[model samples]
Target: MPSRILFVHVCIVVFLFSVPLAFGAQSTADVPVTKELREKALKDILGKTKELPKIEKEYVIGHGDYLRVQVYGEGDMAAADISIGGEPRSADAPRQGRGVKVQLDGRISLKHIGDVEAVGLTLTQLADYLKILFATVFDDPVVTVVLEQSNSQRYTVMGKVANPGIFFIDYPITLVQVIARCGGFTEWANSEVTVVRKGAEENKLFKKNIMKFDYDDFLEGKKVERNIFIKSGDYIIVH
Candidate 1:
């Protein structure tokens, strides 16, 4: 009787200790996606600014950027003030300022000035360049350049996701949410994802920001740091 009682007590003790072990072993990564979690992430990413490394204050114009240029004095040469939706105007109609988009080749094509190299130039730099370019055509052309839209802040997502392509980093987004935005993963997708961020210096050789993400902790809604803040030119690979 004593031997049987001791065995029962030992079994109960083992079961009690094993419960914690099992729970501890279960990572939050396997938790299912919840509305609350997504809402929290959405709130966190939106309305946040991701500063570029090194030059945190400056916003350099790059490929796929849209800019608005205004030229004063001697009238609007390129219709700088033309509204989008208005009746078709005659050749003699008043011209207004216009917005220009930076092509994939990092060049901007103005009405008469042709292509202007815009990549790597700030708004001020581009304004000065435009002034010089327009000076030849107009008498003392005072130019102003403003960034209308920034496509240079786009990030690339590839591998395992449904729609893998370049996605604009309109706001600060996390790795996991970005994957969802790309249409989630495929059947053969792996839980691990890799992130590659470009260095700030164009010429200088520097270490790339390479990080890994484990999707398991995310599944259980547990506090995990797998979700990282992404920036422009950052690439995410979900394998």
Candidate 2:
């Protein structure tokens, strides 16, 4: 009877341990990934996280920008130059001529050429065009264009970040990099970040001029492609 009671106790112990193991396995299996969860997971990734192709990094002219146009060896005609205002020391000195700000109308007035369109053209393209325009005034004019101040290549970050403010960018940067630039997220910051893009054309990657970036998902390697590049005039908000 003693041996039989000992055997029964061992059986009860084995049964108790085995039941929870089986129950746990069954419980975990019961919660299969639901269709809604599957769809949301796919939506979070599709058309969102893919890295964009290498975009041309050339800076284009924009409104409210300051430009310095120099015509070498033409100091007498330097009054026609567009630069920050200063009288040239000599006829041969680099023309520190008057600077012209890009007007709201996207045109700059030259002394002789009048208002010529300066927006939407690169510095090299503008210089070449200016050469043709200045040819009528100077004999073989050497034209050079310099961007004095850039006011358009800027973005803003707001809400739930360590540092949130307008930031200037000279090169293409990713959302992750921009977040890092602004000192990362606050303690209570949400991972769901919204990028409000203004004056941007609708594209396959971004629709309705809005992009939803899941920073946490990206960190988890589930949505690795969500680190999209930041563009000018973009507003990043972390809730």
Candidate 3:
């Protein structure tokens, strides 16, 4: 009788352990679809999410930069020129020609205006400063500055893209636009995308599920919110 009782106890232990193993296997099988659902939810909120990198607002002037200086009503200094750093040109040199290069100290020398710091200032802000400086000599000197050529304005794209590299942009760009420029995604690309923005404390991730959209509805411009605006220095990962 005691032997029969011991055998029963052992059987109970074995059955209990097998029950947990069976449940664990079933739970594991459910995980993939759950992950996909979570990804779908994330996409709906973040749009085409990419990891945004740290963006600093420091200006480092470089060669081939075109600057247009206008002095309000004064009008005498209204001209566009490039930066080509060197000694003063000879009197015989062409007056309206040649690129203007930033000096080693990030300064540009203009006729009658002397040396001015061109780095770290946006064109509009720089114009205002020039206006104030010129005001010291000319009465109510209105100033305007324009950048015809610039090497400093650039952003980069990478990961799960056909072509990943640095891109130069002259105007505002969106996340979908950047992806299109990079040649779209690959076969293994995930509907979810992440963007790393500049100055963000952490990376922002976004996911998009292609399965939920109706082919005809999307084509008719029904779902335009899927494409989100992309900022500078955004890293897009389609995985």
RMSD of each: 27.5, 29.0, 29.0
Ranking according to TM-score, highest score first: 2, 1, 3
What lDDT tens digits, residue by residue, belong to model 1 across residues 22-116?
Answer: 98776553575675886567667763564323424567898766678778645433333334445325322322223666777888877668788
Off by over 4 Å in 2: 1-57, 75-100, 109-115, 198-202
How well is each residue in 1-239 modelled by candidate 3, as lDDT tens digits? 99999999999999999999999986764464454686667667767665334444534344335566766555535233544545434312222224344455777676577888887777666776887888788876656676655545566766777877777555667766777787887776765565655565442333331112222343478655545556545555655
Give the top-scoring candidate (lDDT): 2
**Candidate 3 minimal-lDDT segment of 10 residues:** 206-215
lDDT of each: 0.72, 0.76, 0.60
TM-score of each: 0.53, 0.59, 0.49
- Model 2: per-residue Cα lDDT over 1-239, one tens digit each: 99999999999999999999999986864475665886667667765666534537567988767777778766422234454547545322333224666778998777677888989999988988998999998877778888776655788899998888877665679999988988899999889888888755555556687878888788788666668778888888898
Please identify model 3 stretches exceeding 4 Å from their true place: 1-65, 72-106, 136-139, 201-226
Say which prediction, candidate 2 or candidate 3, comes out ahead on TM-score.
2
Preferred candidate (TM-score higher): 1 or 2: 2
Candidate 3 has a TM-score of: 0.49
Order the candidates by lDDT, highest first.
2, 1, 3
